[model samples]
Target: MSIAIVDARGWQNTLDLKTGEKIDAAGPVIKLVKDVLQRHPYPGDTDPGSNRWVSDTAFDLIDRYAPRFVFLTYAAQYFSGRYTPMSKETRARMISDVFLEAERFINRSGFAAIAVGTGDMTPLLGFIDVTRLDGLAVCTHWSTRYAGLYGPSPDDMKILEEHPHIEKIVSQEEVVRLFDGTPEQTLRLPEYLMLAREGYAFKTISDAMRIPVMIPSLNFNVPLHAPGHTVEAITGIRQILEEDLSEKNVALIAIEGVGLDEFLWPHRPCRNSTEWYYYEPGEAQYLTIVSGRHRFLDYPTGSGYKYFNGAEGAARSYPFSGHFKSIPEGAFASTFPGKSIAVGNKSMFMHMVTGADLSVECFARNLYNQGTMAVIHRADKL
Candidate 1:
């Protein structure tokens, strides 16, 4: 019933500053996020680094925003680009180091923190015991929804016809075997099952350790595409949370942020450039405060995975491109049948939902616009 928008700017960027910048004496490094939120980045994006002076007083600002919990995010700056490409062992070590550093900052700040793990964290998180933290999110592979690709192929997507794309990928028998180390799942094609094994191995190990793992999925991204869709998606999310809370020890919801080339931007290049379902700013508040963890809560925007909720029907997304475009008046056209187009292009829903994006900017719609309508509970208006 409590929450605070914690920025996980990764670990490295915490101290690294722009030239001529002085690190504001030691403290939680969320001042930049605070300034961007409190003071409009109006007149274009304000270099938050310039406001390093605010880190010293971040706690004061947090006190003013007073909510329930906080998200201890790892900043990306040099870390993401620099290390995201390293081997699992290397990335895991870096992630673990970041975890230790993050804990120190969170303790110093006096806030109950939830761990948001993405990027090179899957197998690595399994290496640590996360139950000691307020919460931990075992983020699955970013490209898993593509049936295991940043963009999956028809063959890869076949099995998911019966399950949510992510569920199908992570829950694969092969993946499950890898999690427990067995040869039973060899029945499935090696290519399809191999990539998933990594994530499933991580999730399985993390869960085995009884770490408070938050399950993230493209499913929760449903709420932001349209008002009507948002209503239904929110209802589904609440239902999932309420059920888990009632049936389980702690309930968590994983809704991703929807944004322009958001942080999880193509961890590795794929066959085609594609983005997936994530929660935008205002969107995460409802789910986070209400249920559990949604990746990139700080990012603003998302797509949905309705199959996870059940009863997925025909729906439309923003339709940016790649879902079969119009000829545009004499543009060279293909003979792909119109009848088959509707049914054949069903995949477009996923693209539009995630790849397209929220029609409005979250900065204008959520951060700047204040009212009773908010995903996470806002503090008393100063």
Candidate 2:
């Protein structure tokens, strides 16, 4: 039927009143619930505040509405007191206890299903007994910071291993695939079969072949800095859509971060090479070039002269197919623009393209190592 999406922050007595006064400790919790519900209408004569008086109200709403699903959205750090002036451990336990109580209530009430909407609430996902919930979902943008917030970490894997209720953990690839289009197909027939099927006229025949349709390459420049280090490497990637590669598309991805231990902190100069690379749509071609601390790499098959690194130099480009044998640690990769690129111990090759064409073959060839052998095309015209 219908669903109730509860924001725990709204229920807390932390809002500024119309009179510019804070809700007092003696303020009734029901009043807070009523205030929130008043903003969101209720059906029939049902009182939104009444159901919230006790934690059971969460379940009561689900049961009464008989909604196809009930969603709970929360900020884990805020709920666990990381953002507030409270004991972190104590607040985490308190929030966990409240949710556990809510789960117990939901179990007693026969509702369709309960889903938790983690809006950048990754840390709390592990803290909760997700196994008891019917379903769970995470949503966030594709920036490095947001990706780190929502992406599964070691802690998440541990929780998945221990919890059975976590039916699925959606990935960025899957989400992107949900928005891609299907492939086109054609059939071939023998001359006799064609004649038997229909009145055939003589026509020129072409070889059975799959010609690669090259999409225009987009350039992404990212800056990297590390203090007191002799050499630092920065890398950046962005997902590109096939439709966005048209000649009319003028958008370009640019770098915005200076090298530093913490990306949000100030920048300092260090000896480093900043590189940009991306995959060609519908083809296996990895194009990469190094700019800083060295001359720009040469295009695969172009003739251009450029100088950098305090000397007359030339650029040399290479196909990244199988070239990225390893990805260094501290290197950051993202499908969205405006993310810093850092290189550490692990060898990595990351790319982000425009549009919604997120084929598994392209993703695995560019990011993860587990995939079929990818054919790398060297740019003959540069």
Candidate 3:
């Protein structure tokens, strides 16, 4: 299949110092998105503005193309204050604003079968029929990193359980069982998993902050199948995708950092993970939805794609393997017979996670104004 990939990373970034800081060129997708939203702000200004730009762009894409399946990942909440120096309260306010603005656009976007990252948005989106819980957060015992790998110390484990933020402590063995058992070396899953209580996320021994965080949860009614968990929801999303897409559209909006506490969409109580099961890198989490299988490829440090199968070059992407041999089978988009599009601001994620026909992601280079690019299949790298 010939899929069109559009990268919208630096759409608002237009400064070229060599050219006297002139505004950069805007791509067709950016132009279209800007036209619909009726506002354009440099994404670097604030966390809410960055996320809203991405979310609004996704809404506009769906409205314009009316594709069969739409997958969106919003990243500002996760990226904003975590790395940069910002007060915790300021970060929290920015996230709230992003969600609030997203709620307004999603309701008016006109798609009926919408799935979001949290149960918090479910009630507000009266038109939504299905929901999935994501961004679930858990407290980790960093000091026990090496010790827990072998087997957590009984005394240390007991101490971890006493923490006020901890709801339950899941051990390495228990975590292995959760993903149906993976070789510990392959994924290097966390050793001592400290599941956090609602309204709290573990930061440091001195600081367990009460903030919105996420951990992976059971894939109940979601479109993709997760290997170990039972689909408790009445209608599975896989069935819905294949059956309904013949006559309608489905939107899967993944709010990256906002979990149940932050995104709270009022979903029926479903199972959350005992601890994070994927590799430490954030991209691994997407595999649960895209491939619906275990972590077959192991990434060393940065991106899975960068090191996988010796795919080299600065771009860090490979061809569309179509689950034929290169990657895991049953990738959602690889199976789709119709047009599917994935759009997100997270670098290299849209193409890596969903094998959508047309994948659009924020340009990794410049977040300010450079603009989006399309990913096309070459004999070698993307």
Candidate 4:
């Protein structure tokens, strides 16, 4: 079976089987993606067929071709709707209605929808019925928490407070409850979003709105934003990735490589697929993930420092390891880099981390057979 990409505008594009995860979205996934949009219908345009991507052709292709994978862009995400003239309530309901309709249609058509986006989707939690949904919608918030970095679009705090069933969602019992995660630099949002795109499943920001969210992993490109260009943002993003040791660097993005896989490139029929990468000129070659079989690179890329040196290029991603190590606090404190007394076959070293970001850990660690195992460092020490 073949695959296809659906843009946020609700248009379709033939999925390039060769590119793997960088799936191109053209045909209408966005309801207005290709509308050139005349609302009242110009002349005979009254017929739905007047529009191409969202017209009969797209749905017909969906029915006939019946692709094995349907990739939906986050054309409907928080940033996507900011420009719309709709009020917060109208916008929420409008986007909610669009997604619910898409969910029902995709379900009825018998295909899993890997809904993709770039920000805190938790706001929509109050407005969406996730139980009836299948597949996943991958995006990033601050660390595994649903705390939105920017404006927290549509502000679920206000929405849920007004919701009659808000109790089921909020942590506080007060009717004036409002949900807020952590607020840091807005510059980091793009990099974190890119991390979401990288499928790192890093630490997700949390809040009362924090729910176990994300869809599937499949290599696809949503062509959004990249924040590594600036020295501060790039340096900050890299700090969290390589080491979020200090509180100062912690807020940039979650360094925990927990749900890295399941958030982006899906792990299925692609089960046979190994080594996930997104490489380009002068940018860091994100090794992202190497799944399934027990495999390791013979030689290290040694490009660790490049990511922060302003190479403005891709760093050979190696600090990322599919292995998780937990160090017992007291004894493990002495077990610093390259001098640990852990049990292992060959004498070797790896970048180790604790499972501080629970939400991201839960989302990423179990993505595939390679799986994520936690080291009980703190608990063991305690």
Give the winner by TM-score.
3
The lDDT per prediction is 0.25, 0.22, 0.44, 0.22
User: If both were scored by lDDT, which would come out higher, candidate 1 or candidate 2?
Assistant: 1
Candidates in order: C-alpha RMSD to true structure = 20.3, 29.0, 11.3, 23.2
Candidate 4 TM-score, C-alpha based: 0.23
TM-score of 3: 0.53
Residue 4, candidate 4: alpha-carbon lDDT? 19
lDDT of 4 by residue, 198-263 (tens): 122323211122333332233222211112222121112222233322211111111111122213
Residue 77 in candidate 3 has what lDDT? Answer: 62
Q: Put the candidates in TM-score order, highest first.
A: 3, 1, 4, 2
lDDT of 3 by residue, 1-382 (tens): 1223332443333232122233434455435434543333225412456766666666665666555777776666655533345565875776677657556656776543444452221111111100111212222221111112223456545555575545565555665566556474435444444544433334432213222223222222223222233343322434455555666666666665454455445443332222342232244345544554444233212211111222434432233221121233455776776656676766666665676655555554323544453332111111
Top-lDDT structure, candidate number = 3
Give the alpha carbon lDDT tens digit for every residue of 66-168 in model 1: 3222222223222232223456475445444443454454555553322222222222212212123222223222222222222345643554334321233
Runs in model 4 with CA error above 4 Å?
Answer: 1-64, 83-86, 112-382
**Best first by lDDT, ranked:** 3, 1, 4, 2
TM-scores for every candidate against the unseen true structure: 0.29, 0.21, 0.53, 0.23
Residue 226, candidate 3: how far off, in angstroms? 16
Each model's total of backbone clashes: 32, 27, 28, 50
Decide which is better by lDDT, 1 or 4. 1
Q: For candidate 2, which ten residues in a row score worst on lDDT? A: 188-197
Worst 10 residues of 1 by lDDT: 336-345
